[model samples]
Structures are given as structure tokens and as C-alpha cells.
Target: MRIQLTFVLLFVAAVLQAQDIKISTKDNDLKLAALPYYSYGKGLGITSADSLFQLNIRFRMQNRIGFIKNEGEDDAYDGQIRRLRLRFDGYVGNPHFLYVLQLSFAPGDVGEIHDGENINIIRDAAVIYRPNRNWSFTFGQTKLPGNRQRVNSSGALQLTDRSINNAKFNIDRDFGLQAYYLNEKKDQFSYNLKAAVTTGEGRNWTKSPDNGVALTGKIELFPLGSFTKDGSNFEGDLAREKTPKLLFSGAYHQNNNARRTQGQLGDDLYQQKTLRSFFADAMFKYNGWAAMATYMSRASHNPVAVDPLDPTLTNYAYVGHGMDYQLSYTFPTNYEIIGRFSTQKANKDIKAFTPDTNEYTLGVTKYLWEHAFKLQAEFTYDRLSFNDGSTKNNWYVRFQIEIGI
Candidate 1:
């Protein structure tokens, strides 16, 4: 309780201090100002007059309510705080050097812990160095250079939530060093590349628990010029591109002798295995219409080994393939309608334990103030098939409101 209280107090103090900071001009060269904003949340941003240094304090929250109906089971309804985040981003001496620090302060954010209260608050703590326009380097903890949806901010998602495929196969976040490069022509990006090396374990692990690491690389090509206003990173055609835009991306990732049960997010595995994943995706946008598709596969070099003493016990990594197709159109009134189809299948070898599933989702989003303040609702139908040839079906409806500053 004390630890949790401390975190809350610190967050409150930071916000208060930022608001109290006075703006001043000393000889017109050393000027400091606090810019309070209420677009996403109520917060204050500090910046130097010359724009060489900046500090933005932002807070965001998501509240969700949902109901689920499982095959042959009673319907369940629930409500919870989906996310509560405090973000601090800025540059110290020069704009070329940037840093981001984000924290999550929700009970659901911290799962059950054995030692004490689950106070693992840090989400992203990274420093980026941009030497030039074409290249940059990042160090510390952040999202791995993996699938496109996995890299997209959860707060910016078009649907009520990400697809089930993403929850199962996404690499999530890790501690790593990332290198990025881009080639552009006439203010339009032609190609871009990102590479990273990281501890296979997920966030909050102070050290690598295994001998090996995870390596990932992704490359993107823009054939019809870059998506207007970085549409490739976001959902919907909010930018309403006047000209057609297309993007093709591919990524390869490998975890050498991974220890985590879920490769990087779950409990430690009893035995390590080499895991490999491949991804390909494409995006196209014209006017207010946008479409995207992604295909991903993950496999283990060796199957799980049965316990020597217990025949029924085994440890292994998930081996499966998944694909997602999404389409969306935004109207002039800032209302968007989206539809998605996603499916995943376990490898034949693991079919006995893992079930194949398909999901269909349709949603509507009203962007009151872009993604910063939006209301979204979705209905998803899920079908699961077991190895025994039997099938189960389930469905859910969810409504979420996103608030950020």
C-alpha cells in the first residue's frame, strides 16, 4: 500500500509542480514557459523559448465496459479501468537527444505478485539520439521492432481493443537498443528500416534471465509516397489523403533460447527453445478509405519435452500463425466505421493443446477530438476449434472511452 501511495503522490506532485513553474525571460535568450493543455488531459508542458529543450507531462486513461457470452455458458458482464498512464517526454540539452518515460498506475496493470504489491509501474523509459534526419539510435526499454499493430500505441487503436492474434503473438516490449534509418525523396519517404537487439524477457526484468537475446529487423517501402501524416502508424484515414498512398512492410524476429513461457511476457519456461517469427503487412489509403492486412507466423525449433518423472507434464513455446485484415472509412463528421477479420491456427504439432480460432469484429468510433478524446464500441464474434473436431463459439460487445492529454 505504501509503495502504491508513493507512486500516486509522486505523480500528483509532478503535475502540481509543472503547473506552478513560472515563465520568465532572462535577456530574451534564456526563456522558460509552461504551456497547459487540455486536449487529451489537463497537464502542463514546459519548453524553452528557443525550442532547444522541452518537457511535456501528459496523462491518459481508458475506461471500458463489456459483456461476453461463451458457448453453452452464462453471459458475463464487467467494467474496469482499461488503462491509466502517466507520460513524460522531452529533450534536455538538444532536440537531437530525446527521452520518454511512461508509467501505468492501474491495479490491472500489475498482476498478482508473490513478493509484495505489484508496483511495477514503469512502461517505457528510453532515450533516443538523432544525429541526422535519416538515422537515429534508441537505448533503454520500449516496444520491440515487431508487428505493426504491436508497435502502435494502444490509445490510438481504432477498435475497442487489439485483435486476439496480437495478444497471442505480439512481441510486446523489451529492454533494447534500436537503430532506425530512412531514405526520402522530395519530402516523401521511399524506404525505412528499423533493427533492434534486446533481452528476450519482457519489461521490469533488471537482467537477462537466459544466455540468449532477441534480434528483430523491419523494413518498409512506400511505393505511392509515404502515408499522409504518418497514416501507416495510425488506424483510419484521418488524414484523408488527397492522393493514393501505399506501404509495404516486412519483419523477421528470432529469440535464441528464450526462457519465458510466452517468449517474452509470461512465466519462465522450464526448458528453453529457439523461437522464430516472420511478418508481412501492407497498407493503402485513398481519400477517407483505408485498408490494412498483416500475416505473422511463429515457430519453435524443438517441441516441448515431457517431464522425465511425469508423463503428463510438458513445457513448450506456442507455435502458430495468424492474419488480420482491417478496413475503415472516416466520414466528414469525424465518425469512423471499421471492420476486421482475424484468424490464427496452431501448428499441427501443437494442435492437441492449442486451439485454432477466428474472430470477426465491427466497430464505430466517434473522434470528439481526434484520438485524444474518442468513443468507440465494437462487437466481436469468436469461433474456436479443437483437435477433436469439436468447436465452440463465443461473442462479446465492448464500449470504451479514451482520454489523453
Candidate 2:
């Protein structure tokens, strides 16, 4: 009953805004300008307005099936829920505060018996006080302005998983307060700086009485085309000027953790210590090609050391590196072929924190029926190096079909 009432209220509010809404009825009444509501799960919805001071909602359902084969083990097949999301995003009032309440259902055995019922908040639900074009202050769940790749959604990532270095450098999404300023220059260059105070931990947990602070910054070189002047969008008046036909970006980050701990080889629990990390990333893009690389390292003040006499003490600093490359060529009709490669390595110290595995993948994609349907195939290989001096190899092939309207 409560859910139904909420839907009713939403519908009424949408109707009330219809009088002021300007829809492109003559353009194509049957054609939708955009899908206001989206979900990865099993359903979708729409909004009457899409601009600022508007209302939007989205929902989605998804499923995934995976298989693995090794030398001694038979084929391993498992199917599970990928995502089940319901979200409401919009703005309200004179201050123009934005808010979103998202509920997600995913299969996990974290605190539950099997894949039990799990619902929680996800993503930035904040109000942006963008008083001007080059500055903004946001308060709520948001990503710390770190690397462009880290700020982008996981769905848009080129790799199947985030780099271990990225994970170590920045806490994914955090509940915090932040302020940022960004400006694009008429000479085809841009820069941004942001600082935030967060719980240090991820979004899953609540605020600790004593939280940590993280600072991040990014600089971009858009040599291909000018993006904006000092305070306004750059015009194409200088198209005749010769410019580098490529784009480049780089970022840096640092986080201070006052209360951090890790486990040992024969650990009964993770010990607490002072932790700190630093990261750097760079990206380059030409007409039809792109490449990215990143490195991160974390050190502790009181490094944990194993007891030589007991052979139970364990201690080691953590470090990692990741690199990725992609090349694609799109025709006038939007048909294209893409190739990608990525690699990540971690320092081998302890069994769990050590670098003992790596993965490689190759994929091809084709679009048909005006891009409403897509077909793709991917092949992946994983190599594992055990601490006990053993090696294992596994591979898999995947085929997928996707349709969108």
C-alpha cells in the first residue's frame, strides 16, 4: 500500500508540471525524446520532464551466467542476479536541491544465509549548489573527484573489474561533503580540483566519530577542439588554427587513514595501524584509438612484521599497477569494431595480499538493425601463481545479445 501511494503521488506531481513542460509533440509524438526512468533489472519507466527542476525515475533487472574450466576440475556453471535497482532522482524548491533514493537488490552472502534479500542505498543523492558555471558544492553520496576512470560508472569501464590500485587509492563511493571547481580554456585545455572529507570507508558503513580526508585533482588536454573560454563555452571560431588532433588527461590522489588494519599469515584478526596511499593515472585518445595506465601504492607507519621465532607474524606493504588499451573504428552508419587489452599486477608479500594472478581478454562486437540490437563475443584467460609454488590456468568464451529501444 505504501509503495502504491508513492507511485500515485509521483504521477500527480508529473501531471502538475505538464502545464509548464515543453514537449516536442510535432517532432514525433510516437518517438520518445529520452527514457526518463531506467533500470538494469526487469522494468522501466518514463518522466514528463528531463531538464533541471525536473523529475526522473529508473529501474532495472539483470541476470548473469558464468562458467569455468580447469585442468583437473570439471566445468563450473553458476547463474545469479546481476542487479535489481529502483531509483528516484529529481530536484525541489528555490535552492534547487537534488535528491535520490535508490534501492538495490543483489545476491550476496555477506550477512545473510544464502543469497538472501538485500536492499540498500546506492550512488550520489545530493543537492548541487552550482552558483556559477565553473564551481559547485555537493553534499551527499558522491565519488571523490579522483581519476576520470574512477569517477565513471563501472558499467562504462573497459575492464571486467576495477584495478587493484584504484581500489587501494580511493574508496569507491562515499558519504561525504565536498567542494569542486572546474574550468575549460579556449586553448583546448581544462582542469579540476576537488577535496572531500569522508568516512574513509565505502558507502556500506555509517560515519565513524573520527573519519579521514581525501584530496584529488585532474588536468585535461583537449588539443583537438576548444571546449570553453574563461567562463563561457568555447565557440568554434578558431577552427582554422592548427591544433593537436588528440586528447590527454592525467590525475593524482592521496588519502590518509588514521585507523587502518590488516591481517597476517596466521592471523586471528586484522591489526590496526596508520595507513596512507597515493595514486596516479593518465589517458590518451586519438581519432580512433585510446590508451590508459594507472599506478597506486599504500604504506603503513607501523608495518606489521611476522614473529621470526613463531613463524606466525606477517607484515608487508601493498602496491599495484594497471594498464589498458582500446582501439575502435566507427563507420558513418555507426557500425564499428573494437579491441581491448588490460593487465594488473600486485606485489607478492603475503598469500592474500600477494600478486599471484592475472587476466587477459579479447572481444569483438557488431551492431545490426540500426543499432537497436547488438551481438558480441569475448574470450578470457586467467593465470594463477600460487604461493606454494604451483600454477593454474583457466579460460572461457562468452556470447551475448543486447537490444535497446
Candidate 3:
């Protein structure tokens, strides 16, 4: 109810402001326009004259239906609005200065309540400054520079969802400042670098009582030139490159004296401890085929802590390593076939419960208009081995549709 009220107030304010402001020019420099679209998502955008001081508003939602069966349990059917998003982005005065504000209205987006409020809204509120073509800076709340799969927008994914490895090891989002630099040599190769410093806490945290910070750095090398139309950020061979294109990337991130249960997300930890993570990935695309492989690991300086209430009670942090490999082929009709394999294991020394897991998935996607309008279905098989030498298996089949404007 609060989220709905806030959205209404914001919309009203925008409407009032638009009514009061009017641009006058002799050469017709002032212009007003609205673009309505429907593909993967549906929404409208309003733009100003000269392409400066523009406001774009868009809404996106994903509907999913699936069934999961555990080793001995009956199959369960489920349906959900996986994601419901509202986004506003534009620039003020100059194109070099840009901003983005996004909100999530889905029930699943609202996590545990904090400070008497459940913040399902406000996913991103960031400003970017690009002084030149080679360097740029960003400030505010956004996704941290981490694994390749995590950085890709959820709406643009080729499959129904990301792999389990990404959920376990990816550094999601935070409030921070980032610096980026890119150097390109025409069709030869390209080098990209990024660095960030941020509050270790996850999104929408009003305060960081832990006083800890996370540092991250990433570098990428494009040996056969960069992907077409930010293709590196999107999955599959949408561009159908005539020649081979490859990207090699690596990243390192550390949260100094973190207080969160899962480094950045989850409940607050009882004790502060340092968390370190590393990632390496490679991507290749040729003709209508694409493939990628990634390795990720996380370690905690102090994985276990003694409970204050009970002398024998203890808690442990999540420490583990994982790998993911995926391949996809897109036919001329815009139909795609996808396959993926992932495996992960927790640190053996920890006394707490940690399960080793392996997953295999196969999926098919048909794009009516690239990623903007697509229908996808996938099947996944999972195997788990617990510390007590017990094993379990599960499988799921899901179907999803995405439409965007």
C-alpha cells in the first residue's frame, strides 16, 4: 500500500512540473515527443527537444509457470510474476550527465522488513558522468562490477533465469562510486577497466552501522574486437557475427569487516569479518553460436562464531567455490537452443551445514523481437550432497514470456 502511494505521489509531481514548465525558442529548439512501445515490456517515453533534459518511463514484467519435484515429494505447480519493474532514466542539460531510477513492485522483491518498512521499490538510483569517450564515473546505488552473468540485466537473459552459481557468488548491488576506462583499437582489440568503492550493505539500507566498505576491480580484453551493439552484455549471438569475437575478463572484490550474513545481502551478522571474492570468465561468438564459461570463489576470514547465549552454539558464514558453462545457438528464424552446467561446493573445514550441488539445464527461446519480446522454456536437474553423506535430487520445468517496449 505504501509503495502504491509513493508511486502516485511521484507521478503527480512529474505531471505538475510538466504543466508549469514550458520551453520557448525562435528556431523551434524546444520539442515534445512520446514513444509507446511493446515487445518484451510495455511502456511509454517522453523526450525533450535537442535530446537534452529528457525523461523516459518504462514498465516491465515477467510471468512464469513451473513445476518442481523433489526426490520423494509430489510435484508442485507454481505461477508467479517473477519481476515487475518501473524505470525512469534520462539526462539533464548535457548528455554526458545521465541518471537512472528504477523500482521493483513484485511481491518477491520485498524482502524482510527493516526500520518498519519493506523496501520493494528503489532498485537503482545512480548518476553517470562521461567526460569523454575513454573515461566515465558513476555514483549512487547500482550493481557492483562482479561476474559477467550478474551484470547482465535480468530482462535480457536468454534463459528463464540465471544459473545457481550466479545466485551463490555474484556481488549483487550496493551504494558506491565507480570509475571506468576503455581503450579500443578499431577492429583489432579493446581493453576495459573498472573500479568501485561502496558500502558493503545491500540495496535500500538506510544506514551502514558496520562502517565497512567493499572494493572491486575488473578488467576485460576483447581480442577480436568488441561485440556489436553492446553484445558482450547480452547473451546469444543476436548479431550473428560473420567473424569470431571473443572477450576475456577477470575481477576481484573484497568486503572489509562485513556484517551481512551473505556478504552484501541477507540478515546482519552478529560479528564483523572480512569477505573476499574472485571471478574469471570468457565469452566467444561466431556466426550464430555463442558460448561462455565462468569460475567464482568466496572466502571469509572468520567463518564460524560462538553463540553468546549458549557455550556450544555456533554460526558459520557461507564460503564456497563454483563454476558455470553455457552455450547457445540462434537460428535464422530467431529461435535459440541453450544448454548449461554448473557445480559448487562449500569449504570442508566449516562445522556448519554446507551442501555440494551440481545442476544441468536445457532451454529453448523464440524471439519475436530480439530480447524485447521472447518466449522461453527450460528444464533443470539438480543433485545435492550434504555433509552427513546424504544425497538428494530434484528437477523442474518452467516456461516464461517477456514483453518490453
What are the Cα lDDT values of the candidates? 0.76, 0.45, 0.77
For 1-405, candidate 2 gives per-residue lDDT tens digits of 353355346435544544443433122110001111212222243334533344455544434455668757999875665545555654454223445555566652122322332233454455554333444456676565555455543433333334434544444565555555545455554555555555554454442434344444545555444321111111011112333333345555444443333211011123334445444555443332334555545555544555555767665534345554444444444344555555555544445555455666665555453222445456677677766678788887655544433
lDDT of 1: 0.76
TM-score of each: 0.86, 0.66, 0.86
Which segments of model 1 are wrong by more than 4 Å? 1-43, 48-53, 116-119, 184-189, 305-311
Decreasing lDDT order of the candidates: 3, 1, 2
Tens-digit lDDT string for candidate 1 (203-286): 888644667888888888888776654566677888898988888889998888887656777655667778898888888888
Candidate 3 clashes: the total is: 7
User: Global lDDT for candidate 2?
Assistant: 0.45
Top candidate, metric TM-score: 3
Any residue pairs clashing in model 3, and if so which? 39-404, 40-372, 40-403, 40-404, 41-403, 41-404, 41-405
Better of 1 and 2 by lDDT: 1
RMSD of each: 9.6, 10.8, 9.0
- TM-score, candidate number 1: 0.86
Better of 2 and 3 by TM-score: 3
User: Model 3 compared with the native: what TM-score?
Assistant: 0.86
